[model samples]
Target: MRITDLLKQDTAILDLQAQGKEAVIDELIAKLNEGGRLADSQAFREAIMLRESHSTTGLGDGVAIPRCS
Candidate 1:
């Protein structure tokens, strides 16, 4: 299916009220969980946190692409 098809109204946070990196990640993960996107939210969170420990994912211009396995 197309990515647009997977997009949902409840999963979209128009106003991101997070300040820092971890907070943003937490907020996003919470949204994903609320929308029933993942099997284990805690595991996904730990994986992303571990990845962040290596280095920041900033690609410049106020952009960050955090990926998880």
Candidate 2:
């Protein structure tokens, strides 16, 4: 599917209320879980946290692309 397809209203956060990195991850993970996109939220959270520990996904200009596997 295309990126637009994945960025539907169910999974998109128009006005993020999170204030920090971890908080942002948590919020997004919650959204994903709510959309039935994650089998285990805890596991996904751990993986994402581990990935962030290595280096930030921020690409500057207020953009970030966080991913985990």
lDDT of 1 by residue, 1-69 (tens): 344633689888779899899999898889989998878999989998998898887898867766564
Q: What overall lDDT goes with each candidate model?
A: 0.81, 0.85
Compute the lDDT for candidate 1. Answer: 0.81
Off by over 4 Å in 1: 1-9
Query: How many clashing pairs per prediction, in order?
Result: 0, 0
> What TM-score would candidate 1 get against the native?
0.77
TM-scores of all models?
0.77, 0.85
lDDT of 2 by residue, 1-69 (tens): 355645778999989899789899899889989998878999989998999999998999878877764
Candidate 2, residue 13: CA error in Å?
Answer: 0.4
